[model samples]
Target: MRISVLCDVKPLLGEGPVWDVRAERLWFIDSLGRRIYRCTADGAEMRAWTVPHAIGSMALRDGGGAIVALQDGFHAIDFETGELTHLVDPEPDKPNNRLNDGKVDARGRFLCGSMDTGESDPTGALWRLDPDMSLHRLDDGIICSNGPCWSPDAATLYFADSFTGEISTYDYDIATGAVADRRTFAVLPKDRGGAPDGATVDAEGYVWSACVFDGRIHRFAPDGSVDRVIEMPVCKITSLNFGGPNLETLFVTSMAEPPLPKYPGDGPQRGATFRVEGLGVTGRPEPYFAG
Candidate 1:
């Protein structure tokens, strides 16, 4: 598939692309820039809000605002008024840990993971936040937690630890929001300098993952077989998801690596969002955080 530039903004670390069906818009973030953005389907009518803390990821809430993973903890952000309502801080003492990639499940529960800022510790953990405002720790020993998505049937869950170059799957109990039977699903090409960043599942049960430094998106079948690969123009592909009227368009987010010393701003295709049209597979609707 061919990649087309969707938005031209340069983000230090752009990630978390969420398609809002009701609003007909796409929401994403510049993590390092501490900004959250929204744009129309065609990448027009762009708007953004600058936050006080680093934003790892976010999800659209049911009524309004957003459930945001800030540097210290989770908060409800009112984009219109720039108001942040304090939520629970899962990691109160781990100053180096911050929330990373996340998504809502079919049961209306939000599942997210955290990562150590230095990318050198196994202190990160996957967490579940229920609609009743309860938090559950799912897994630990994750270094750089990144991707967290579910299968099309909601019977399995997929997550990745970018620092370890490992992607794993688990048998999920949808009713209880519990996962069991952890197995290695895919391994990123560590020698090639790419690590699995963020991922999403397609209608055909294919797991599409962005290789951060490899400049490619890998599609894996249900059995963990490589099904297809999409080449990208830039490295540091941070995250991706399906969006559009029919969920046929795949939107990708990227980050510029090793900022230039002289100019520090001159780079090609870095920190830009892209769209892959006609991907042949459709994406399921991203569930909103019901809290």
Candidate 2:
């Protein structure tokens, strides 16, 4: 499929693409730039706001505003008024850790993770924030938590520990938002290219992962078999999610990290958002955080 550059701002770290079906708009963030962006489906009327500080990811709330994973904890952000309501800080003592990639699950629970600032220590972990505002730790021992999504049926959880180059699957309990039966699902190639960063499952049950530093997104079948690959012009493919009115447009985000001597493919769109269409596939509407 062909992909086109959507926005050309070239952020320091363009990540967290979320589709707001009700608003008919797309929201994402630049973690390093400390900016939150929103735009129309066609990429016009785009606008951004400089947040108080870095925000790793965010999900639209059911009523209004957004539930965001800020550097310290989760908060409710009012973009129009630039207001923030503090929620919870899972790791207040760990000053070096910050929140990372995340999304809302089928049951409207917000799922996210935290990682070390330097990205070399195994202090990261996966967390779940229930609709009642209660927080729970799901998994730990993560170095760089990246992709965290669920299957179409909501019966399986797919998460990637980027530092380990492994994507692990778990048997999901949708009612309780609990996951078990942990097993390695997909392992990134040991080449110079980086591991999987952000991922989402499609309507047909295939997992699509953006391999950061690889300049490609890989599609894996239900049985964990690699079936397709999407080549990108930029290397730091940070995250992606299916958006647009029909949920058929695949929106991708990237980082502005310069190409390393060993890894190439850094282009003008390195930190810009992308849209991939004509794939003849559709995605389910992402559930908003009910809390």
Candidate 3:
């Protein structure tokens, strides 16, 4: 596979790369930078807007604009007016927790999780925002949440809690938006030097996960066996997604500033977004948040 820098602009904490099928564009977030960016499939015509608070993740809306999981809660973004309207805060009681990684399900429900700002306490929970704008809690007691994706049939949900070193799967009920039968799907031991970060599933049902400190991207079979591993040039690879006209290109995001004390030696391309091609695999179009 061929991998190269997608753009020159680097973000302090780049995460959440999403491909807009309708717009044929790539959208991502600079979490610590408090900025949202969009660019053409070829990494041109890039545009950005700043948010009032730090954003963890975002998804395009079917109607228009987008929905963002900010430090406070979920907000609706008006691209035309640059207005951010607060929708709801699932965990107003826990001021120390902030919303983190999220993805839209096949039925158009937005699923996101929260994480402790200090990254020490398990004060976070996974939440779902339905099309009606109502919120539902799925799981709790998470230290850091990342990587929420679904299987090909939408019957299984895969998620990761970074501090736990395990990626878990749940039996997902698409019609009711409920998750059960939570079980370990994969594991990245602490000795391996990385934890699971962001992830996406391919059209063939294989899951691709980014190893944050390990500088590698792993492809896992449906049985949770490691199929292949691609080492990255940068050290702190944060997230990745499949984009491009036919969804053949893999777009990756990374972290730069506030370097981890344990994992040092970040290269010059530490925070740059990367474009990977020739993977010989394609991805399904991510669904727009119906809300």
Candidate 4:
């Protein structure tokens, strides 16, 4: 496969990568930078907007604008006016926790997880935001939340708590937006030197995860077997998504600042977005938040 940098702009903490199938564009967030960016399939016509607080993740809305998970809570962002309207805060009492990774399910519900800012406490939890704008807490006692994705049939949900270094799978009820029977799907060995960050599933049902300090992208089969591993040039690879005209390109994101001293050799493209092509597998279009 061919891997190359998609853009020159680097972000402090590049995390979420969302592909807008209908618009043929890619949207990503610079969490620490508090910036949201949009670009075409070719990485041109790039545009950015700065928010007031650090952003965890975001999803395009079905009606218009977008829904963002900021440090404070969920907000509706209007691309035309750049106005951020407060929606709801799932963890209002836990001021130390901030929303992290999020994705829209096939049934049009937005699911996101919160993470403890200190990265030490287990105050985080997984939450679901229905199309009606109501919220529900699915799971709790998480340290660091990341990588929320679903299987091809939408019957399984995979999520990772980076601090735990384990990816868990849950039986997902698409119709009711419920998750149960959580079990270990995969784990990053302690000797691996990194944790699983963000992930996405291909159309063939293979799950792709970005290893943070390990500098690798791992593909896991449906049965939770390691299918393959693709090493990256950057050390702090954060997240990835499938974009491009046919959803054949894997757009990867990374972080540049707060360099990890243990894993050296990070070049100038550390925080720049990268794309992998010719994987011989495409991805399904990500669903937009119906709310």
Candidate 5:
């Protein structure tokens, strides 16, 4: 499958593409530019919200507001009024740390991770929130945490440290918030280039991973094998989703940084959203915090 940019958001980093099923819209974040955006599914009406500071990820809440993992702390973003309310900041004194990637699990609890803002230190971790409003730090010493997506059967969990080039799988016990039997699902091979950015699972139990340097996305099987690859024109493919009526169109998000010279048909394609004709199974909708 050929992946291309379907829409554009200019920033040092663009991340988090969550699909809002109720509103039929796609909400994502431009990390360093300090903005949150809501766009129509067709890549029109791109509206942005200027955060007081940078935000790593944002998702819908069970109540009325949005939950954002910000550089300063975890903020409750009021959807109606656009006000940011502080909720929590686990590491308030760690000025070099910031929240990175996150997603809501099947049980409606938000799972997120953090990494060093300096981009060198490994003082990061994975966190979990219980449905009963309890919180726990799941892991430690992580760098550039990415996807925390669950399998279609809900028995496995996949997470990535973008800087470390490791995607690990765990035997997930959702009821108890426990992960054991850890194994390397895919190493990503740092020598081959590209880090695993944002990732999701299709109904077929394939992990669709976005790449940072290789201008493509990878589809990895449940048994830890490369099933296929989707190439893109832009080098930084940050996030993606399976949207549209049939949920077969793979919606991709990209940035404008090109490692090489621009080609002829590269005007609006770079930093723009792109969709392939036929891809993905009957996939699950991207979840939100709903907390």
Candidate 6:
């Protein structure tokens, strides 16, 4: 409880922080600072874009622009001319692999993930982004496919495979995305450095996770227990969302390095960007022009 300071898009891998209820503001990225962040709602105006590669997630595309998932492929981020174009690179030939965490399905499609820049084992996979943009891989080796939410009547599908700390639950059928019943749903505690980064499911279905490096950001409870534990002073927090104007305010995204080699940014909660006020929860809206 009690978190503030939403205005630093240091973004050296800020992951994906969303809250774009019809352009109210807040769009994120920093994945290696390839850039992509547009704030407002206290954070004032920020706007950014430098992406050419290395951007692990993004959504919110229906008729405008946004549906990035690059690291190697899957693009379309024209916030209104900033353009990043090029939509179709799925594996391009597997130049090592990238494209992590993503969301935008309630039929709008655009669910993503594709790890393995040497994230230990399991090559990684999980995708879907049809609407002529074409690209459907859906589930694969998966070694680190962080959160991929979808469950506000989208049937039920909330994933995570950050090395497998468990956070599963699937049974969707949103017209065709199909994802039969799974299990676990929330297991955690694998020595504690935690992994399950980025996840969402509010409006009552609680299942908000971040946990990366154990800084804290949890709220599982749909039978999986533990219903709230937002701490995070910063240890590499990767993503989170639920913006202001009634969304209950809660938007975090940290990462000051620490992929292990160390010696890159030092740390101050890594790359900043946080906020957590009255987080009773309320976020579920953002899915546009699937075309």
Write one digit per residue (lDDT tens) for candidate 4, span 1-291.
999999867898898999998889999989989999999988999999999998999989999899999988999999999999998988889888899999999988999999998888999999999989999999999998999999989999999998788889999999899999999999876666789999999999999999887889999998889998898878789999998998999999998774334555468787989999998989889999998
lDDT string for model 5 (147-176, tens) is 889998778989988877878888888787
Worst 10 residues of 4 by lDDT: 257-266
lDDT value, candidate 6, whole model: 0.78
Question: Which has the greatest TM-score?
Answer: 3
Question: Rank by TM-score, descending?
Answer: 3, 4, 2, 1, 5, 6
- Between candidates 3 and 6, name the one with more favorable TM-score: 3
Candidate 1 per-residue lDDT, tens place, 174-253, comes to: 99999898889998776667889999998888999999877889999988888898888887788999999999999999
True-vs-predicted CA distance for residue 176, candidate 6, Å: 39
Q: Name the runs in model 2 displaced over 4 angstroms.
A: 258-265
| Candidate 3 lDDT tens digits, 221-273 | 99999998898888689999999999999999998774345667578998889
RMSD (Å) of each candidate, 1 decimal: 2.3, 1.8, 1.1, 1.5, 3.3, 18.1
Model 6 poorest 10 in a row by lDDT: 260-269
In order of listing, the candidates' clash counts read 0, 0, 0, 0, 12, 10
Better of 1 and 3 by lDDT: 3
Off by over 4 Å in 6: 1-15, 18-27, 30-35, 57-97, 102-140, 148-183, 186-206, 209-222, 225-247, 250-291
Candidate 3: lDDT of 126? 95
What are the per-residue Cα lDDT tens digits for candidate 2 across 1-291? 778988878888899998888898998899988889999888898998777667889988898888889898998888778798899999998898999999999889999999987778999889999989999999998887888888888999999988788899999899999988889998877675578899998899888899998888889998888988888878788899899999999999998864234446476667989999998888778899999
Write candidate 6's Cα lDDT for 97-151 as tens digits: 7888888877678788888877876887888887677777767888888888866
Against the hidden reference, what TM-scores do the models get? 0.96, 0.96, 0.98, 0.97, 0.90, 0.31
Better of 1 and 5 by TM-score: 1
